[model samples]
Target chain A: MIRVVLLGAGNVAQHLYTALCNQTSVEVIQCYNRKGSKLHPDQKKELVTNTLTELVDADIYILAISDDAIEEVSSNLPFTNRLVVHTSGSVPMDTIHSSNRKGVFYPLQTFSKDKTVDFSTIPFCLEAENEKDYNLLKELGVTLSQKLYKISSQQRNALHVSAVFVNNFTNHLFSIGNDICSDNDIPFEILHPLIRETADKIATMNPDNAQTGPAIRNDHKTINRHIKFLSDTTQKELYQTLTKAIQSKYGKKL
Target chain B: MIRVVLLGAGNVAQHLYTALCNQTSVEVIQCYNRKGSKLHPDQKKELVTNTLTELVDADIYILAISDDAIEEVSSNLPFTNRLVVHTSGSVPMDTIHSSNRKGVFYPLQTFSKDKTVDFSTIPFCLEAENEKDYNLLKELGVTLSQKLYKISSQQRNALHVSAVFVNNFTNHLFSIGNDICSDNDIPFEILHPLIRETADKIATMNPDNAQTGPAIRNDHKTINRHIKFLSDTTQKELYQTLTKAIQSKYGKKL
Candidate 1:
């Protein structure tokens, strides 16, 4: 069995604690949080540690902490030469400090509070300093998910940026749609089906070919109408900018 | 059974034809395409009419045509004072010629070619000149889908603009994400689960509370790193603009 000492008590940490507990071949030996108050309440009191020195010996030390705290925490770890990994997409594997066998166990999925994510489909992007560590991470990852990518720091960084675009920014666009609906006294639920379909299309089709609407079609009449319809200055500017971006994407000249 | 003459041969028209054909209480008596070559091949040759004058008498003449053509087609219709509607999100109902009882039967969802949409969940926004025409349109709408809203021409116009943001603009963002993945030699599919979950989250939660990432978190370090990582000038500019927009949205200072 692979034993793990989970670090941090944030969303990712709580989720990791639950997922690891369910794995027949894995045991979350301990969960460490700087503030003991933040640790999962369901975890056994004995298995919760407030100080780094009290962390039990484990096969993997999973640092499910914030990006800024990664360096300090890894450097402060009581043990060295063990596989230490962080669940960060942007932070590099090397950020875990040279005192330990640094690696990354980034789950490329958004972890929202109170939401139960399907770990089976969440792609776990793994990186390590050696073959044994890599295989060990993979073995642990496989217990939680089917997708495990051996990504480097550089590639994972790119993926994180891409993710920000697709997930974070896309949600922002949905917010804009919500705002537009509210301003016009329309229900936001009206756009739910369209939102779902937009995401569904990309699963099978190339987005380039899947793209539709006035911006891609260069329907200036409709585009101008939409621009005039939007009352907010920022939203109008965003509309124009994204319209231009889409037009340019499809090779349409200004 | 309600008899209908369907006009135009675009994505919307084709999808409507298939959907209406499946409804036991509706009969799409004729499919008219100004250019005969655009007509659906599966439609019976007898039911396909290129010339508007050859359009047979029906309870409703559905113009699922381009926005620009809605005016001319409705004006030249061989009949008068009948329920004539165009399935366009942007086009106002009155744009249809006064010679016919004007209405709008806008299905507020992106209709892609060969993508069999689940008509049950698609919101059909209906508007007409009179209560009788409105009821007739709703009858037809309900035959195909459960969602039917008596939205005004103005409200429908607003919904159309909002659809552009949520559906069209959101798809472009997906395209951007795909490009980033391609540039980094990362398979775009790696981002699919994240994309699905992002859309899924908003179905249950408000987009405002659903928003997450470096920009919303005001993590300038990761945001700056992402901007630097993007090689394309336009992509970088888009990244900066969207980042600023998100910060501004959540009341964060510049």
Candidate 2:
């Protein structure tokens, strides 16, 4: 069985702690956070330490802190040649350089404290300093997730940028949709099915191939009408920029 | 039974044809395409004609052609006081100037020819010239869709802008994500579940409330690292613009 110490009790930390506690082959021996943070029920009996001195010796130390705090916590932790890993997508694996065996156990999915994560389906991107550490990290990842990907720090960083595009920027568009609906006295739910269907189509088709719009057809009349309909300056600018991008990509004029 | 003449053979026309055919109350009296395009298999036996003179008498006429073509086709149609309508989100209801009983029968969802639409769940945005025509259009919309919204031409145009943001622009972000994944040798499919989950969250939570990312957390270190990771000029520009937008929204730099 792999014994692990989890640091930080934020969203990612709570999620990983719960998953580890549920797994038969892994045991979360300790969970650490800044002072005053409560521990999960499962870790009530396990050491829930706030002090840096309480950092326990374990086979694996998983740092689930924020990107900025990773270095601060890593430097403070007592290193014992134990494998130290951080669950960050953008932070390089070397951030936890205090350990002899360092790696990343980054789950490429968002987590909320209330939401249950299906780790078996979540893709875990694993990176390590050496082959032995890589294999161990891969094994730990596979134990938690059915899909494990071996990616370098640089590649993972690219994936992180892409994640922002798909997740963060996409959400902003949805916000724009919601704003439009509210402004027009139309219930935002009217567009829910379309939003869901759009996402579903990409599962089987490439986004470039799945694209359909006035810009794709070079329908400038409708494009102009849409631009006129948008009253917000920021939204209008976004529409113009995206429409131009689409036009250039498809060799069409907007 | 409602006798209907469909006046186009494009994506919207094909989808509407199938949807109308599936309804027991609606009978397609004739199908008209300006170019006399090959009819879909289910529409084969239905009278297919290129000339408007061949059009049979019907209770309603649905012009599901392009926005620019709507006026030209509607002007040429042999209207016999039939409830004439055009299925376009951006086109004004008065585009079909041939009939005083003109209205819009816009299905407010993206329609691909091959993609089967769930008519029962799709929202039909209806607009008409008068109360009597509005009632007729509402009844027809109810037969095909569970949700019938009485929206004005102006409101429909606003919704269309919102649709562009949520659907077209969102899909482009997905394309960027896929490009980044392929460039890094990571399977784009790995991001599918996360993308779906993000959209799913918005169904229950507001997009602003559901937003989570480096920008949301004001993690400039990770954002800077991501900016460096994106090599393409367009992608770098997109990253900067989106990061700035998010930061501006949250009143913090990232």
Candidate 3:
């Protein structure tokens, strides 16, 4: 069985620990953090530690820390020439100390520590310096997730920014929707079904095929009315800007 | 049984017709349009007509036409003092000619002509000048959907604008995400699970509570990197604008 020392006790680390525990073919040697209290309560007490020197020997060390902490954390690891990977989408694998075999095991989905993720549906973006390291990561990935992408560091960076658009910006729009509803004394629950369907439509069709709105239609009358209807200055500007951007995209096509 | 004479053969009109067909308590006496060719093929030919003059008697008439055409079509209904409603969120109920009773039977969800909607989940924003007409529309809504809101013309207008933010603007952000993925040679499908989960999260939590990203966290380092990483000028502008908007929202709170 392959053994792993999971570093950090954040969202990615905790989620990976949960999924890894389900794989009979793999074992978690230990979970390391600056403090043991950060580790989930369900984590085996013996397998959780705050001291970096206390890390057990393992086939691989996965650093699931924040981007800024990655280089220093990898440099602090006492082991060398063993497989070491960080679960970051934007950071280069070379950030790990060159003394160790470097790889990336970025999960291409947003994680909230409180929310349970179905690993089978998430795409694991993997990169490694050697064939053996790649295979090891691939083996682990296959056990945890159905989708595996052999992405370069450059590709992973691009995917990260794209994710910000779909997840981050989309959530902001939903927030603005909530703001608008609450401003007018309407409950936010009324918008839930539409939001769910919007995401579902993109599954069966590309977003380009699925796009529809006054902006795309160049329906100036409706567009102006909406702009006037928006009371918040930021929301108004946002409405105008996105509407123009959408118009430009489809206007070129039409 | 209460009868609805559905006006127009557009996406909303056709979907409502299909839904109304399933309700044993409601009947669609006729579907009025300038051209019957747009009518769904499964609709009985007897129930479809191209002439406005050939309209049949019904308890209510729903003008499921375009926003620009709502006023004109409602004015030319060829009948007087009958309950006439237009299925538009943005249009005011007063747009209907004064000769007939006016009401709004708007289903607050995006409908594509080809894709079917689960009527039971869609919110029917019902509005009328009087309680008698409101109850009649409410009776129709009760037969079709579980979500029925007694919204005023003013509240309905506010809901329409809110729907634009949640559905129209949210979809555009998704399209931008797809564009970013395509530009960087990443398949848009990689982001689907994240997109689905983002929407799913808000069903149980408020959007503000669910929001997470660089701008919300004020991570200017990552934000600048993403803006520089984006090559398209328009996409870059959108990124900066939305990032600033998100920052302003949380920056105030922070």
Candidate 4:
């Protein structure tokens, strides 16, 4: 069994800790965080320490800290020869100390403290410097998740950007839709099924091919009508910009 | 059973036809299209007519034609004081001849020919001139769907705009994500779980509350890195516009 020491008490840390506890092949023996930040109440049974020097002996030290905190915490960690890894998508794995067997164990899925993730379905993106360390990390990932991908730092960076588009940008669009519905006195629940269906369709179909809109059809009358219907200036500008972009992509006149 | 005549053989027509056929209370006695358009081979057994004058007798007539074609077709249909309706979110119900009981039987969901929609779950937006016809249309909607909403033409127009945001705009963002993945030589499927989760989260949480990203956090370092990583001018502009929008909304600076 792999003994794991978790660092930080943030969303990712809590999620990783819970998922580790659920895994039969891995044990979270200890957890460390900055001073005054307590461990999860349920994890009090484990050796939780605020001081880096008090961290328990473990095969792997997993830093689930923020991007800016990686270097600072890695510099202060007690062990130099042990395997050190960080769970970050955008930050490079080597951002941790090179003295240790540096690796990354980034879970590509988003995590919230309140939302329990099904780790079996989550994709673990693994990276390491040496073959042995890489294999160890892969085995750990495979134990926690059904899907494991070996992605380079550069590729992880691209995936992070793409995640922003699909997750962040798409959420903003849903916000816009909710706003439009409220402004018109229509219940936002009416659009929920449609929103779910939109995401479901793209699972099997490419977004470019699944696109359906007045902009794609070049229906200027409908487009102009929608633009006029939008009450907020921000929404109007967004509609205009997106409509133009779609038109240009499809080789249609705006 | 309510005998119905469908006027058009397009995407909306095909979806509505299949949905009606699944219901025990509705019978599509005939389907009418323009002179040369090809009909569905499966629908060959049903009476198909090219001219409106040869329309079959039915209690309800549903015109599932385009917005522009609504007026032309409505002018040609021989109204027998029956309940006449058009399935368009944008077009007003009065666009059909006023000689009959006018109504709108718009299914507020995007329809693609190959995609089979769960009509029982789809929200049917109903509008009619009088109480009797409105109730009749609502009952017909209930026969095919469990969700029914009494929406005016004006409200339906707003919902259409909202649909564009959640459906059209969201799909474009997905396309952008796919493009970024392709350019970076990373498989686009990596972002699928995150995309699905984002949409799923908003179904339970409000979009504004669910928003998370570099823009929301005002992390200029990551934002700048992503901007520099993008290769195309159009994508760079899109990134800038969206980031600026997010920042403006949250009163965060980047």
Candidate 5:
């Protein structure tokens, strides 16, 4: 059995804890949070800790904390010379302290504390210092998901930025759509299917080929009309900036 | 039974043709395109016409052409005083020739000639001058889709603008993600599941509430790191602009 001491009680940490509990071959030896009250209520009191000194021996120690806290928490760990992996896309594996074997087990998905995500569909970006450590991380990754990527620190950094673009920026665009609908007294639900299909299209076709819009078509008349239609300055700015970006990418001149 | 004439030979017109051909109650009496070669290959020669004078009488005429052409084509039609609609999101219903009963039959989804979309999920945004014409358009809408909206020309205009943000801008964001992946030698497929989940999340939750990322979190350190990591000028500009936008939306001072 693979034993793990999970650090942090944030969204990713709780999600990881719940997913690991479902695996028959993996055991979460203990879950650590700065405040014991924040740990998952279902977790047994004996298997949870508020103090770093109380953490027990485990095959892997997964730090699923905030990016800013990662280095500090890893340096403060009581145990050493064991495998310690962080579930951060931005933080490097070397931030896990020199006393332990470093690795990364980043799950490339947006997480909410209240939402239960299906781990099977999430991509687990794994990284380790050696072949054995990589295989160990891969083993744990397979138990939770089939999509495992052995990414280097640099590659993972790039992936993290890309995630911000696709997930965060994409969601912001949806929010703008909602705002526009609200302004016009149109129900936001009307745009949901289009949003769903836009994402689904990319699953089968390249985004470059799948792109269709006034910007790509160089339909300056419609583009200008759209810009003039928007009352909000920021929305207009975003529309013009993104439109220009798409036009520049497609070699369409204004 | 309703007899119809479909105009234009573009993606939307072709999609509407294929969808309408499946209905037992509706018969597409004619397909009109300025260039005969542009008509769908499945359309029978007897039913296809390039000249406006050759257009036969039909219960409803759908000018599924460019926004600029809708006015000219409707005015140039051989017959008058019939239900004439243009399948444009931005174009107002009155853009059609005043001699004919004006209406809008916009299907609010991105269309590609090669991609086969599920018409059942597509939201058909219908508009007309009067109740009888609306019901006629709605009747045809019901044949192809379960979702229909009685949107006004003004509302449809706003919806069209919103569609650009959610579908077009969102797709551009995906292209940026793919570009970033390619730069790092990572397969773009790794981000596909995350992209799907991002869209899926908004289906249940408000995009404002569903938002997550360094920008939403106001993690200036990571944001700066990402901006520094990107070598492309346009990528950096987009990153900064979108980051500021999200931060502004969430009231996170940066």
Candidate 6:
């Protein structure tokens, strides 16, 4: 059996905790948080603790914590030569204390406490200082997701930045769309199918080939009308900038 | 049976043709195109013609053509006083000739000829000058989609602009993510699940509440790192612009 101890108590930590508990071959020896109330719980009192020094013996120490706290927390762990990993995409793996074997078990997904994610399809990006630790990380990741890869800290940093562009920035654009709909007394539900299909199209084709709309076509009349329709100066500037970006990418002179 | 004539042979025209042909109560009497090579065939050769003058008598004429071609095609129709409608989101209703009743039958979905759309869930926005014409447009729209709304020209323009942001801009963001992944030697599929979930989250919650990531949290370090990582000047500018936009929207003084 793989004895595991999960550190931190936020979204990623809680999710990893639940996933680990579900597997018969793994045991979460304990979970620690800086504050007693912050630790995620499902009445699993035997496996919860608040003090950092109270962490018990385990084969793996998974630090699914914030970016800022990773270095400090890993240094404070009162153990040596154990497999210590963090679930961060951008942070380098060497940030873990030199006394322990440093590794990363980054799940390439966004986690929310209330929303249950199906780990089977998520890609687990793993990294380690040595072969044995890498294999161990891979073994645990294989149980959680079917897809696994050995990503370097540099590659993972690129992935994280790309994620911000797709996930975070895309959500912002959607909010802008929602604002336009609500301001015009139109129901936002009307756009759901379109949005879902837009995401699905890329699964089958390259996003460049899947792209459609006025900007790509460079229909100046429609483009100008849309820009004039938007009342907010920021939105107007964004519309102009993104339109120019798309037009340039697609080789449209406009 | 509602006898209808369709004009144009592009993506929207082909989809509408296939949809109308499936209904038991609707008969697409004829479809017109300027070029004979563009027609999609199913042995219904007699109903399609390339000539503008060789049109048949029908209860309604549906001009499912480009926005620029709508006014010209609707004006050249041989029949007079028939209910004529153009399937355009941005085009005004009066673009139709004065000899016929004017209306709009806009299906608010991005259509691809290869992708079969589920018409029942697609939103059809209808508009007309009077009660009788509006009912005629609604009757046809109900046959195509369960979700139907009576939208004016002004409102339709707003919805069109909003669609640009959600569909076009969102797709562009996905492409950028794919580029980053391929550049880093990581498979682009890693970000698919995250993309799907972000879109799904907005279905249940407001996009404002659904927003996450460094910009929303005002984490300047990560944001700065991401901007510096992007080598292209245009993409870097976009990252800064969008990040500032998100920060300002969430009331963070960036």
Top candidate (lDDT): 5
Task: Return the DockQ of model 3.
Answer: 0.83
State TM-scores per candidate: 0.97, 0.94, 0.97, 0.95, 0.96, 0.96
- Residue-wise lDDT of candidate 4 within B4-116, one digit each (tens)? 98988889898888778778888888888885254466776448888888887888899989889888778777755888899998898888876777899988887888877
The parts of candidate 6 lying over 4 Å away from their true place are A37-42, A252-254, B37-39, B252-254
- Give the winner by DockQ: 5
Q: Summarize candidate 4's per-residue lDDT along A133-235 as a digit string, tens digits.
A: 9999987888788788889899999989888888988899898888878888998989988898889888899889998889999899999999988877778
Better of 2 and 5 by lDDT: 5
For model 2, how does the per-residue alpha-carbon lDDT over A1-254 read when each residue is reduced to its tens digit? 88888888788888888788888888888888876365576456447878878777888889898888888788777665778899998888887766557889999888877888888889898998889888888777877888888889888888888899999989988988998999989889888988998899998888998888888777887888788777777777778878877777668322
Which window of 10 residues has the lowest lDDT sum in candidate 1 chain B?
Answer: B34-43
Better of 2 and 4 by DockQ: 4
Q: Which 10 consecutive residues of model 5 chain B have the lowest summed lDDT?
A: B35-44
lDDT, residue A220, model 4: 94
Model 3 chain B lDDT-worst window of ten: B35-44
User: Candidate 1 residues B92-158, lDDT tens each?
Assistant: 8889999889988889888878778778999989999889999999999999889888888888888
Off by over 4 Å in 4: A36-39, A252-254, B35-46, B252-254
The DockQ figures for the candidates are: 0.85, 0.75, 0.83, 0.79, 0.88, 0.84
| Candidate 4 clashes between residue pairs 3 or more apart in a chain or in different chains | none
* Candidate 5 wrong stretches, greater than 4 Å: A252-254, B37-42, B252-254
DockQ sort, best first:
5, 1, 6, 3, 4, 2
Model 5 CA lDDT for position B126: 90
Q: What TM-score would chain A of each candidate receive against the reference chain A?
A: 0.96, 0.95, 0.96, 0.94, 0.96, 0.94
lDDT of 5 at A218: 89
Question: Model 5: which docking level applies?
Answer: high
lDDT of candidate 2 over B97-199, digit per residue (tens)? 7553799998888777677778888888998888988887887888888798899988888888888889998998999999899988989988998899888
